[model samples]
Target: MPTRDPDGIRRVTDAKALSAMANPFRSRMMDALKVDGPSTASGLAQRTGQAVGSASHHLKVLAEAGLVEEAPDLAKDRRERWWRLVDPGTRWSRAEFADDTAALTAAYAAEALTLQRQFERTQEWNANAASVPEWDAAAFNSQNWMRLTPEELGELSGEIVATLLRWSQRTVPDDGQEREPVFVFARGFPAQP
Candidate 1:
């Protein structure tokens, strides 16, 4: 189960909750809610290429797991229901679920699917890179291999999230001002045993 931290983050630490989040549809719905704010099942269905009923089912599954919750305020009508992410992002330790091979595989597979989707998005951006000169110039995609103690790796991960959260808190636009959303991803893991 997720517990709200002092910072108002619904941090998920339970293995069962992580397993519940391993489904592709549920994962996609969570990402959509995080990226696009509150929306209805129909809207998410359109975005995810799933039927409305399928989308609704996935949304309910996520809600049961506490990754998302109904946002009645965003609903446009009595018939429509709006949902949003409980947290803008979630973190889990694979090691915690490792003992349960089935759950661990599913969770890892979901992450792999997410990475593949991100790669596709990057390709799409590459196709349009020339039109957005500023973004193209500012974008980052680099990798380096280095040795680090496990403690150092943990600190690095925490620092990255802290920095991103500081920026994410300011994403709301000022009056009449327009801004674009930017995605920042970091992958730091030991490649050698």
Candidate 2:
């Protein structure tokens, strides 16, 4: 239900939506929709281990915010409703902040913590799967020092993001075969003087 802009990108312009997703449960719900595909509220509760009522409430909130769409499920019981993510990569406009530095900071902190937790979980999974020889494992840890204008740095960031997208496109899931989840995290910023 989220509105698509001229570029075909769904724009999450609602401040409430941003704050709603700041919650861990809602964030997990979004991730579930993106990774596991469309599912009913009951299905999401089962996957996330959340109470059915809680999942249903969060789904309603997401739907109101245009983050998700309810699809009629013909395969399931006639009464059951299926929910799907409107846009897996939806983003907010800076104008939404409108000089509210405190709100913006809080939102950024919450997002950072969520991403950190995800990375930690993935690392734990990788560590536990070390005995599995069939699992593909690779880790790259390195830093670079370079001098560049702001424009150059922005370009570099775009190139890195594009490369990662390409990698994701090349990855194909094995049907009915168990495989390790691959997690990639990169943090880059100017060094302190």
Candidate 3:
């Protein structure tokens, strides 16, 4: 069995888990929960535009698959149950989806939608970046072409994930401090056209 990684990510080689995550809305809910931390179904519905019942149902599926869990610490009352990601992130190889066509197709579609969401958010930030001087100065948008073997590519990917996880784990004290959530999404793929 593989051990825990520094990036707080659990690589999913199981086709069952992959199929469970195939739904676009489920993926979005997971992303929102990751960003907002522990959140109730109503909160997710407001952020994700899903009905409260629908959010609850999808969260149940994710929870059964060990993707998300209840965070009672953040709940306001007995009736409310907050959800959070079981891990900081999820990753899977192409091989994991190779045997199941439905799972593979769903996985790709979910990834495409995720990238679209990221692009939209980036545009939104770039438009208002000037108003927030700190973020504006620290924000980045860069791309470079690299020629490397598969081993080298994997090594580089691991390094980036570790660094990002370290930064992501840094929390802010809620003592009247100005704070905002930062989304750090990264992708490394072939440069082929």
Candidate 4:
């Protein structure tokens, strides 16, 4: 297993858990819980624009996979059930599942879904960027092409992740500043396109 970070990023090595989290809805639900904190099925449905029953079902699946857990303390009454992410985020590499063909397929599918979600979010922001001109200067899209060996590429990837982790761990001041969730993602791989 990979080393745990201070930010509580869970390293998933189990094939069953990887397969369980490979669903698009489940992935989004996990992200929602991580960002918005514990919430009930109805609240998750509202946030995800999914049916309440669908949200509930997915939450149960996630719980079974150990990605999320019930937050009894956050519930207002016995009837209310709240769910929260077991960790701030999850980390998995296809390399870990190389021995298992099925697990490797699941990991690939999960990675594809994640890339799709990131692209969709970027497109949505671009479409409505004019409505919030304040973010214009900060919003950015960047890419570069470089020649490097596998080892160098690995080092670069590690540095990028470390940089993002540092930023993620920073404490936002409670000075009434208008701040919203920001999504950050990066990819580095050998490309011949």
TM-score top scorer: 4
Query: Taking the tens digit of each residue's C-alpha lDDT, what string does model 3 give over 1-193?
Result: 3224546578776555666677777888987987777888999988999899999999998888788989999877898798898888787776667887876776776567677888988899988999999888888877878998989999998889778877877766679977777777778878875
Poorest 10 consecutive residues by lDDT, candidate 2? 132-141
**Global lDDT of each candidate:** 0.78, 0.72, 0.80, 0.85
The total number of steric clashes, by the backbone 3 Å criterion, in model 4 comes to 0
Off-target runs (Cα >4 Å) in candidate 1 are 4-8, 14-16, 171-175
RMSD, every candidate, angstroms: 2.6, 3.6, 2.9, 1.9
Clashing residue pairs, backbone N/CA/C < 3 A, model 3: none
How do the residues 66-160 of candidate 4 rate in per-residue lDDT, one tens digit apiece? 88899999988999999988776788888888798988988888888889999999999989999988887788888999999999998898788
- Estimate the overall C-alpha local distance difference test score of candidate 3: 0.80
The Cα error of candidate 1 at residue 77, in Å, is 3.8
Pairs of residues at least 3 apart in sequence or in different chains that clash in candidate 1: none
User: Which residue ranges in model 4 land beyond 4 Å of their true spot?
Assistant: 1-7
Return the top candidate by lDDT: 4
What is the TM-score (0 to 1) of candidate 1? Answer: 0.84
Can you give the lDDT of residue 114 in candidate 3?
72
Better of 1 and 4 by lDDT: 4
| Estimated TM-score for each candidate | 0.84, 0.76, 0.81, 0.92
